[model samples]
Target: MSEEEFRDFDEELSEGDPEEGEGEVEVVEQELTKELAGECLSLLSRTGNGLSHAYVRLDLKNRKLTDIAAIQSFVHVRYVDVSGNYLEDISPLGELPQLLTLHADNNRLATINLKELQYLQVASFAQNKLTTTEGLSQPMLDRLNLSSNQITELSGLTETQLPCLTSLDLHGNKLTSTIGIHLPSLQKLYLASNTLTKLEGLEGLRQLTTLHVRENQITTLDGFAPSMEGLQYLNLRGNAVEVLSELTKLQCLPFLRGLVLAECPLCELDEYRVEVLILLRGLERLDKDEYTEDERADAEELSKQRAEEEAPENETVEHT
Candidate 1:
């Protein structure tokens, strides 16, 4: 696919169905029947109190079904897997009061709004046609994965208040920037294979440890902020960062230990590794390669000599 693979339509979000293929074999839509539920429902977890029992899990994957109106009756189910289906709307699942985990990947879902599932913990809607993540408001959600979707922008994320969220994976989307996200409690964030040009609006993410913006259009570290104290890993491979001196801005990241810049323009320089090490002595690894003890000592010695040489320049300027 081309670089501008994921197309965007201004700022407006559209939930319309994707264009169908020519002469595509149509599969008849099927509803959730009691007999199918009986075959799919193998009580994975249960709790009993007198004559009452709570069902904890159900696997309804690859059922080729369209409607799942029967799950609302199974109120005790905590985990549900309805992936690989022809589901276009999953609003019926919003009626599930005790739902904890929901896997609805590889479906034809265009828009998802689980309607503030209070007890929902983990949700994955990967490989779907979701164009926006606007209405998914879960207070207790910890991990969310929306990979391989056509999501153009991240709206209503901060306004939703995901207090317990730690990991968010939006790999392979159409996002053009990181300006809309402002999650402070998030730790692991994946924005790989997007259309991002620069990184900003994420400086307040103090707890973030891993950030994957690889295969994007990022060309500079001018937006890097020192307030991001907890980030230790940043992947910037396959970007357009060319100026070797631009890496000097990376010194603001005091806690950064691993950085990936393998396919960038600066990686072609002969003194690339030594120059990067000289700038940021704290980095322990670079582009899938760990720094050896000998390389560290050499960098330290060169750094001292380089500082000494620049000392006379400062002294001359002072005298002037």
Candidate 2:
């Protein structure tokens, strides 16, 4: 950026904050003025019609802005970055009918009720004070990041609201269960570092490939259904899973290749690795370690022996 892009602080700010304190920084109320807009706007491009010129990217990061009512006039902008600011209200951006991408992390936004942008694809509102997913509705959004927020429940989110969503990051939230999420098209889901005790209502997400629920209170694998056939990577590390039977529920995931269970209470068992491989023979990696040839062969033998032992009991019951 050129030197002209930076604003010159007044004499009072250059010296120090005299009344506030020696090290404290005061937050002055600010707005997105027309002059500031002209200074910040940079990426020039042709419109979708290819007839008119317009600035498509408006980056105003770390401007400490509280309001942005002036952005409504920039109707042609497609990408915006207003992160690291003191903004608590951004309803002014709802006017950008052509916006496709937005990054507004680390803000003071308590509620987000923007008008549905049909072309929006990528959105990140991480590290905010959002309590729910009530107002986040983007029809064409592909990737969304709401990590490190105060979201307790996905009350208003559904597959119908985010039909095209593929990747969702909701880690570091306050979610206790996975009930309200109904996104069937999602492939990647990050729900680590939450207060979830059990996994449920995720059978609808048949297309999910990666599921990260690390560092939670989950003690068993009761919620996994046989319909999750596309799951490849399952991260359940740093949980309280101690029983060996909890992994039987994951045998339905035919495509599962990676499974993490380190730091769990069961990892301390002498035959933890061998037992897991015996139950889920399809796993190629476990706890960040790839299985060796000998390990796979030994587990295969143990699995056949275990299954044969159970076959006699089943046969006796059927004969009766």
Candidate 3:
């Protein structure tokens, strides 16, 4: 689909459905069975005037549905999952001002704008035809999953302030760099299976704990900064890491507990496991196996012996 179709809207958030789409109006009024409507209407608050907030929480997942224009009547819907559908236009949902969490994965939607959603917290737009993140500017968002898309850049996200954002999943995109996107409170970041050649933009995230950058073109550890001291779990399984000494940068991360280097070239070293255990002294797990206390002690002893064996050559050079 063309990117021009994803234009930003300036529509004001309001109550009540639009006065058009008589076909959808019939779907909501006639197609709904009496038993299903009664069960769903029970979730609404009945007033002296009429029924209020119909279908506030709707789950129409994998129902083989094609048209969701009927959702315009759910004015007070706070959470909705319309996954696995053939919907191409969710513009009808922009009327629901109280929307919070939305799960719209596995659809054919090429564009959607929820900038008016003030209280939105979590959003998942994965497995779609979206080429950009144009209309996702909610300030209260905490988690976002936009994996398995054709997204090329993170341009639209830099305009908003996401102070409470903790986790971001951008795996299986065409991202080449993460230079402008900055979230101070971000803790977990997943950028696996992308085209990243370096790890430069993550220097400012001091609260980050988990980082998964596997299956990329990263070949060195020089890009990692000291601000990543709080990182505990790291997965760099299938990167271009070739040298064992490159892992020395990990010494700055004191809280690191688990590390994965399965398919990397460094895992083929003669003393791979022992050298890694010695470098990252307090690691409890390496690759897929958990290390025991005795193994750690043995690795420490071997490291000391190796250091001692290389000491006399330095003394002879100093005397000469």
Candidate 4:
């Protein structure tokens, strides 16, 4: 054979034949396409299934969910988490009849219709462009996290609709004051990092356990309710509260444990300190950021004593 022909034959053998490589590449491409199509079809079928519980998460993040009509088929879905998507309007989610939890945070949702979610228990709409908080009717909701929104007024959540709401987070919002929020079952409230100048509309919640109102313009605790008998943790740090005497109403809360009062303009008043000691008799953690070494030692001693008291008892009996 000629040298050129032999060289071509050797190249063909070294490259494993072009036809074989082409066939292998085609098979791989076809398999990948089939797998992609199967996943899409499975998602579509799941949207069509009207089951009571559905979880379509961990895969749809950052994906554009433009097909709103696909959600109408899943009418029986109780919990739906469509967070981290590029969804514009979530009005189609209202079509679900049994939706209990809607976690649509970190989305481009400009508006939300809360009237459709009657069975919703936990709704997290954080990081949205919501200007107002209107049209919510779920009375059995337990937690509502609406932080990082543009809400100016809180008049939308009335007393009757949020009767069973336990935790509410409105941090980093534009709330100037706390009005029209008559939550009776509220246990923990997070109103930190807002534009609140005064604290109001939290008196009726006798079941309050934790109250976080730090980094606000609150100058007084005038509107603090004495009926909050169940409050345990209170974080009022970085406020303009001059007098700590207003916290005297907390004496009613026998379970008060932790109190954070750092950065507030407070003086060492003997009577007020005595009152705080009386009110927080059951307190295990008190952070003022100004505790001297001696004071910290005393606190540590008290904590050790309390721990000993809480420890299980060991008994010894002597026989006659």
Q: Largest TM-score belongs to which candidate? A: 1
Candidate 4 CA-lDDT value: 0.63
| Cα lDDT tens digits for candidate 3, 14-55 | 121222223453222223233442344324543223554355
lDDT of 2 at 55: 90
Q: Please identify model 4 stretches exceeding 4 Å from their true place.
A: 1-59, 267-280, 288-320
Off by over 4 Å in 2: 1-26, 307-320
**Stretches > 4 Å off in candidate 3:** 1-55, 63-69
Residue-wise C-alpha lDDT for candidate 2, range 225-302, written one tens digit per residue? 877898988888889999998898998899888888888998988878898998898888888777899998899888
Writing each residue's lDDT as its tens digit, candidate 4 over 36-66 gives 3224322222443455334332133434453
TM-score against truth, every candidate: 0.88, 0.87, 0.79, 0.67
RMSD vs true structure, all candidates: 6.4, 9.0, 10.4, 20.4
* lDDT values for all models: 0.80, 0.84, 0.71, 0.63
lDDT of 1 by residue, 1-320 (tens): 12121111112122322334445658797999867876776665555333666556888998987999887777777789998888988888888888899999888888885787878999999888988877777899999988888989887677357878888998888999787777788988888888988888888787888888888898888777888877788788888999888888888888888878888898998778887898888887888677899888888898899899999999999999
Question: Looking at model 2, which ten-residue stretch has the lowest summed lDDT?
Answer: 8-17
- Model 4: weakest 10-residue lDDT segment is 5-14
The whole-model C-alpha lDDT of candidate 1 against the native structure comes to 0.80
TM-score-based ranking = 1, 2, 3, 4
Q: In candidate 1, what residue range of length 10 has the lowest lDDT sum?
A: 1-10
